[model samples]
Target: MKDRHWRTRYRVGAYEVWGTSLDSEERRRNAPHAEPADFGLYLDERWHGEEDARTSHFVYWPTLEAPVERALLIARIKEAAAALRDGATVEVACFGGHGRTGTVLCCLDVILRGTTAREALERIRREYCRYAVGSAGLENFLLNDTGDLVTPEPLRAGEGR
Candidate 1:
C-alpha cells in the first residue's frame, strides 16, 4: 500500500498472505495496488461485532487460549494462500500489528516458503520490522511440521511428512 515494499508475499497452498501494521480504514483503502484485489484479516477481540461481518474481512477474537482456533488458522492460511496465487492481496493485522499478526505472518511463511518457523521468525524480524515479536508457542506450532494436515500428536523427528 502507498507504494511501500511489503515484508513478504507468501503462498500457502493456493493463497497468499501479506503482512503489515496498518489498521486504519484509510490505510486499508489505499494499501493495495488498484489491480490487485484485497482482503482484511483482523486479529482483534474487540472487532467481533456480528454486524461488522463482511465477505472480504475476518475478525477473530484472540485470547490466551490461543490467538486462533487451530481449524480457523488452517482455513485462514489456505484462503490467504489462494488469494495470493490468484494475484489478490490479503492483509493480516493485530492490535499493534506485531505479536499476533507477526505470528500469523510467520505461519504463512513456513507454509509457503518452506522455511522452518524459527528461520521465518528471524527473517520477519530482520526484513519486515525490528519490532516483530511473534508468540513463542505459535512459533513452535508452526515449526512442528506435522505435514499439511494438523494432528493431535506432536510431529515426530523428521516427520514433517
Candidate 2:
C-alpha cells in the first residue's frame, strides 16, 4: 500500500474524511505511487495551484478568520459531501492543518451527521485535531448557522487576520 500524507482521518457517519496540510498534496504529487485523495479541498488564500478541476478546488480563505463567503463555503461543503457520497475520499487542507482545516471538518460534520455546531466542534476536536476551530468567531459563525459573511471583530487591536 502507498503512504498517505493525511494528518488526520476520521469518518462522519459513512463519509471518510482525510485532513492534511497543503504540503501533503505537494508531497503526494512528487512521490511515486502515493495515493492521492479522490477529491481535494484546499483552503488557503496564499498559493493556488493548478489541480485538476474535476478533482480539486481551492477556496480563498485567510488564516484564523471565519470564511466571509457563506454561499461559497456551504457550496464547497456540499461538494465534499457529494464526493463522499460517491465513495470518494475527500481531503480538506489549509496551511497548518489546524484552524481552517478543522473548521471545514466540523462543518462537514454538521452536513453529514446533522450535528449541531457545538457538537461538530467537539467531535472534530476530539477525533481530528485538538486545535481545530481555533477562534471564537469561527465558532460563533457556525453556531449561528453559518449566515452572512462579515468579518468578526478582533478581540484586541493589532490582531492579524
TM-score of each: 0.62, 0.76
Error of 1 at 70 (Å): 1.5
Over the stretch 30-59, how does candidate 1's per-residue lDDT look in tens digits?
Answer: 545333336656677643441122334554
Which predicted model would earn the best TM-score? 2
Q: Rate the local accuracy (lDDT) of all candidates.
A: 0.57, 0.71
In candidate 2 the C-alpha lDDT for residue 110 amounts to: 77
Error of 1 at 111 (Å): 2.3
lDDT for position 160 in model 1: 89
TM-score of 2: 0.76
Model 2 spans with C-alpha error above 4 angstroms: 1-7, 23-32, 50-54, 147-161
